[model samples]
Target: MSESSRWTMPDMAGILSNKIPQDELKPGDHIYSWRNAYLYAHHGIYIGDGMVIHFTRAAGQEIGTGTVLDRFIFSSSPSHPSGSPCPRCGDQSRTEGVISSCLECFLCGGELYLFKYGVSPGVFIAKTRGGTCTIAPSDPPEHVLHRAKFLLQNGFGVYNIFKNNCEDFAIYCKTGLLVFTNVSVGRSGQATSFLAATTAIVSSPLRFLTTGVSGLAAVGFGVYCVSRYVSDIGVRRDVMKIPVERLILCPGPLESEATTITDTSKEKGL
Candidate 1:
């Protein structure tokens, strides 16, 4: 937590959006919103001009339009009346360029909107400070932005919570490599992890005695799964308990929605 070094989250929050001035946000920096300390629900890349680019599942047709294929949302502050909640905050705006409110995002999944506004409250923003997380060569900031823009131009594709998610997009932009973290969800995920470990342990000898290469391979795979789950579970529990005081925020040009935004907007009609 020193000025010279960057903060690292052992598991969730992956650095906890440690508050810093938004002015410090440069193109290619990662911004995220936490469902809580244990769960980072959204992530995007800052593309300057107060805009962020991130992959989302939210997409639809125009007023008279039908299904559309836009997944990457180019987001910014909404142009709502000053002091009023942003029109795009919930499901209010059907326009393709707004980030949906948390409620809407939770209900129908998220959409990628461009030009609509502000991140959800208590959302955290972060950027790589010194170097890259992996050995992948880090590009210059301009190059990073260009890469992000190029991906956005390609539009969004299928979203997979486990395989392809927001963090994968942001990290790819910054480091030119697709990466996935091992963090999972709450009780259900914990139960699955436990089951995976127990099955691996219980099936080892049986598989070794009864089957051939494929059976042994399954046991090996189980070993890998158990190790991964073991490492992740302890940290996951710790993160859920992290003190709120440890979170960081930036202090610079504040977006208008940052102050007045809430979870109430026009609901999506059937």
Candidate 2:
């Protein structure tokens, strides 16, 4: 594909398979790679120079839920199987919050895939998997790089698998959008997928209408797709554009901070 084609809106096949070679990567690109046998993906911002900045938990604490899931999720940071620090990144396995690592270490033996933004609603739903793309458009590369680098110097608050994770970090860097609802999940598509699956299985209306197992399965899948689509940051109305500096200085939760800022704006009537 030509350079322009690579950046164009992806076709159905391209959307289904979003992999891109390393040579195509540009600064401020959101990239991810599957980890733990495709159980989940680790996401980061490609800020040029073969380095990635991502949010992660400390080693052995990727899953913050403190359940059996932790055993399976595994740390998303760079780790060498031979118990040696990566020559370029230097033992970032235990690093938490926002940190930088070389592209090799970031991939950690996984295949690299580009994250798509500004996708059509049809395309977003057609993707059975969440976290691969979003309907929101990305900001300019310079803005994205600035956010990533700023977070690296400060922090992105704590890492919560459901509300805040690597995917959330990358999404924020790319779009500067943050969920302002305290009860809702963050912008992480992986987290949304898990919730959507549970919602589908437990509360799908199709369960009441369908008698056959196949019918029930079809209903559940439809519910799952709808759940994922509506909860997406791009589609949700509960998000706000917040400056990265404000997030760093806020002493309260992100949602609360956003609310306070909104109220202040209202008082000023600007």
Candidate 3:
């Protein structure tokens, strides 16, 4: 593991899997980095001990040690099911989370839409597989925003379903802002609605997992994700730069000296 070049920091959440043997670690335990002794963070996982998996990142070369999460949650199935298909993405994406539980899909990246059927004007029952129901919409935008802030801060996917036909909402990730258009059942506005002035630089130390139109919408949202390395002063107050412990526990024997990892991405210095 070395300092990343493309990025200067590490951000994202969740790092562990069911196969890690929960007996070695449980929920609310400190995670340490095996590569860099100082790269450490706290997470909530551990169905037992030595078994925990959350979505996080490893050190990068060009990006300068940023998140590159490609993890599996179920330890029993450490290797992604081959031959089997991930008709969806969200459901197929799984890792562990300190505050999130099954937020995304364990199979496909497609989000699990929990839509309910309305039997009446004021009453409704969740027709989805989880037997859920709809609650009354928010009273005002401020209320919606406040609620959204809390949801996101608490490690939940903060989705603000505006109380109108417009499908517009702002997402506050632990890393950056996730704004989308046409994808939400809300209204349309410039990316400014979600992003503060360019100077605000709300580049929170959060990791983002985008899906569907959100990927396209992020460009419109104008949210920037700037990472800080271990040298950054006080950056750890908001969140740790890189989670070293999680990476050390990562399942992998270093690549053979003859092996060469390729940069398959289009981004520069990646």
Candidate 4:
């Protein structure tokens, strides 16, 4: 294959593998670790000195859906198996909102993985799992670090699984983009995966065209992939780049206006 073709080809290895050693971690890097048997992933911003800034709910409140999801998300916070508070973090299991924790506490016994940004679309679609990578480009390390630290002091709004979660927090730190629509999913790929799976099952038009079960399944999978790709924050047009400081000052009204604009665009078929 030509060099250009090779570059465009799906990187199966990159898509499947994102593990990185601790020594490789740099300040301002976006990192995550799988939790709950890979059902979901917890994300954070690495801000050097073996510390990470992440957004999360208080213990026992990870998932605000008021369903069985709360059980699966129970271990999303920083806790040690020894049943003792982390010496460096100091019993943060109940702490909520943006807070800093040591890397060991953040991983919570899971393998370390780096979140990729500015990936090729082929590579993005090839990864069946979401929240692992994004097609959006990350800002400079300094900028990313600034955002993380700023949010750590300010806040990132409430913790909602489908809307504002850990993955959404990390993504916003890396990229200053935020979706305006309140009805839509945030930047978290895991949330997108959930919605896409639902869309594939219920809204896929391919059911009418396919007869065989295998063909139907294939069509559903295609729909799922397309849904994930288009819903990605990098690919969406409704996102607006807002400064972290301004977001902190007027988060409520700005989000309201953004939602209004999104609804208007949809009504006009944009």
Q: Model 4, 1-270: lDDT tens per residue? A: 866547532365687699999999999999999987887889999999999999988777788777776766665778765679888888988888999999999998889999999988878898889999999999999999999999988898888998999999999999999987646588889999999998895796668997998998899899999999999989998898889998999878887778778888889999
Kindly list the per-residue Cα lDDT of model 1 for residues 1-270, writing each as its tens digit. Answer: 664344334312423334435566666665554332322235566776666666554332211112232222322222233434454453333333213233223222333221111221112112111111222334567766766676666543344444445544555555443211244422122223344555664656656564677877666665645443433322222222211111112112122222222112213221
lDDT of 1: 0.39
Give the Cα lDDT of each candidate: 0.39, 0.87, 0.23, 0.88
Q: Tell me the number of clashing residue pairs for each predicted model.
A: 15, 0, 67, 0
Clash pairs for candidate 2: none
Best by TM-score: 4
List TM-score per model, in order: 0.39, 0.89, 0.18, 0.92
C-alpha RMSD (angstroms) for model 1: 18.8
Q: Which stretches of candidate 4 lie over 4 Å from their true place?
A: 8-10, 256-270
Q: What is the lDDT of residue 80 in candidate 2?
A: 59
How much is the lDDT of residue 267 in candidate 4? 95
As for model 3, its CA RMSD to the true structure in angstroms is 23.7
Q: Which runs in model 2 stand beyond 4 Å of their true positions?
A: 1-9, 80-83, 251-270
Total colliding residue pairs, candidate 2: 0
- Cα error of candidate 2 at position 24, Å: 0.6
Question: Residue 109's C-alpha lDDT in candidate 3?
Answer: 24
Each prediction's Cα RMSD?
18.8, 4.6, 23.7, 2.3
